[model samples]
Target: MIREQLEKADAIEARIQEKKQDGAGPEELEMLRIEKARMLRPLTHPNANERVYLARRIDRPHLKDFIPNLFTDFLEMKGDHLYGDDHAILGGIAFFHGRAVSVVGHCKGHSAEENLACCFGMPRPEGYRKALRIMEEAEKFQRPILTFIDTPGAYPGKDAEEHGQGEAIARNLAAMSRLTVPVISIVTGEGNSGGALAIGVANRILMLEYAVYSVLSPEGFASILWKDASRAPEAAGKMHLTAEDLVEAGVVDEIVPEPLGGAQEDPGRLYASLDKAIQEALCSFDGMMPEEIRAQRWEKFRRIGNGE
Candidate 1:
């Protein structure tokens, strides 16, 4: 169903590009707009797989993609100091809404070679270690920390295991939990397993509408439980991975609604709204002491599975 919508949307986009090439009239532009909006109606009412599709949408903006539009003075810091740097996870000191903060997140690549180089945004041991290093620096400077999570999961390869993938994630969780600065996390897209959890132990966690935050991708879960990945849509439905689901379950502090259909449909509006949401969350932590913030976060997670 979502695949069909994607096809239709792509067709409309092509027509719009063609019109631009030929110099479209006002009537042609109007028709194109109406057709695009009509095609999006059903997709806006998305199911589980559609939610996952939006999370991985190629048109959706990424961490690095937002730099020029949403932030400035991005002085990137590299390497974990113990090991080499991982391109999959990148971070730096940046100004968000005129306030300096440590910004870190998964960086998905645009080309096939780039994707392979970054391990398709699936971080390994070095990536997590690098995140910890930058986060500790944020705590030292008394700057707030902001993390953008959009990864399938930690790298699950022989090399990753050899270098302590599990230990890296565990250490990040511990380090982030004890950090004294206010930390805010946003699930901008796919947030899977321990990779997501490592950066998500923040004072407040927010998720974009249509994004998925889960222990495993629906296909993976479906294959394990039903012996058939074809049942992924059903698995997605049962997992409660959508931002709406997380909000209702008290797993997320807030849901930042994407523009009408989704973020990709209107990147400008989406980024503007996201900037506001980040600012508001930061404001909410204004006078909070480190211990108070930690206790609040701890209690918040503890209550997620509370009450049968």
Candidate 2:
């Protein structure tokens, strides 16, 4: 099934090329190419497996791509007071459109060494606590909170467990629930399990059109339920975790549009679109009081599954 998704669009492209070579003039060929481009199927409404693959593509935009492009004056904050620093979850204060905002997100590195250092964006207990610190700082300073979710899950290694990963994530959920400032979270890539939700309790939850967010990774779900990771494609189809599905279900407040294939195809456009969405989200809470902001956030989560 993964192979099916990765199969090149070679045949379709070849057929189009054949038409262009059929003695057409330059102007005619130009028009024909334009028509072909218009008909090229977009991953905007991609199937689950395709969406998952797109979300996992190495070239797709992640927190690393976003920070420099969307935010200014980003000052990287480090460490949880109780434990060591975690590169897996990057959090700091940044200026977004002239206003200060606390930004936190999972970091999947672009290189081998970076990946090892970032633990493939699977945050440990320290990472969650670091995120909590940044989030709380946002509330104290009365700045909006912006978080990006893009991890398979939290680090499940022995050290993480020994350091109380569950407790750290739980504390984040509880603290985020009561934060006095506006919180907006976007799923830029994979959003799996409590690792995603730890920083995802937001007044507005937005997901990229091609990103996949689920309770578990498809491979994990397949291995657990069917005892075979190879059945991941099947598991993906059944998950219903795509942006369109979540938006329709009211789990996501907005679906940020990406390029035809994925964010890697046009990351600049992705940045522009995401910037606008964040601006609008921040503006939405312009005149609300601290308690009002917290109450609105609570009500948003409460309405998620009740058809309100």
Candidate 3:
């Protein structure tokens, strides 16, 4: 059904472009616009697999793209004190609507070279450590921590394991749980496994409309459950991983709505909505004591999966 709608939308779009090139008049353009909208109307109710496809689009905006529009004076911080810098995780300080905050996110690249540079947005032990370091700094300065999660999972490479990848992720979970400063985490894309959770523990958790958060990718889950990775679509349906599903499950505090067709289709509008959501979330913590903030975060996570 989604493919049929896409095809129809694409065909209408092509005709619209062709007409414009041929100096079509306003009436013709208006008619084309109506046709296009009609073709895309059904897309407003995409299924879980369709949402997954949109969430994983390579053109979808990543951390680097969002930071410029949502924050100011972005100064990137690098390197874990214990090891070299991991490009997969970008961490730093920025001012969100004039409020100083620490930001950390998984960053996938647009090009092949850039993907290699960032390890396809798969963090290693060092990457998790770097985020932990920045989070600690935010706590010390009483700055709110904002994390954008968009990773397949932590790097499962041999080197990453040898370097204590599991331990690094575990440390982050513990530290984030206890941090006194308010923490907000948003899953902008693929939020898979402990890699996503390393920076995900927070006072409030938000997810983009089409974004997905799950214990494992659909493919992985399919392989484990049915011994067939090709049944990923089936797994995705059963996983209950969509933003709306997570919200109902109490796994996410809010859903930041994306523009029609998803974030990649209209990033400017998506960014604007995201900025507003972030501001509102931050305002909710105003005047709260440090211990109160910590307690709230702790209780929030404790209630997950409990139908609370």
lDDT scores of the candidates, listed in order: 0.87, 0.88, 0.92
Best by TM-score: 1
TM-score of 3: 0.93
lDDT per residue (tens digit) for residues 1-308 in model 3: 76677667768878988999999999999998888777777788677888888788777899999999999999999999888999999989999989999999999988889889999899999999999999999999999999999999999999999999999999999999999999999999999999999999999998999899999999999999999999999999999999989999988999999866678657999999999899999999999999999999999988998987
Question: What's the lDDT for residue 204 in model 3?
Answer: 94
Candidate 2 local lDDT, residue 9: 36
> Best-fitting candidate, measured by lDDT?
3
What TM-score, computed on C-alpha atoms, does each candidate reach?
Answer: 0.96, 0.88, 0.93
Off by over 4 Å in 2: 1-44
N/CA/C clash count, model 3: 0
lDDT of 2 at 300: 84
Cα lDDT for residue 258, candidate 1: 87
TM-score of 1: 0.96
lDDT of 2: 0.88
Residue 19 displacement (Å), model 2: 24
The residue-by-residue lDDT of candidate 2 on 101-169, one tens digit each, is 999999987777878989999999999999999998888889999999999899999999999999999
In model 2, the Cα lDDT at residue 141 comes to 89
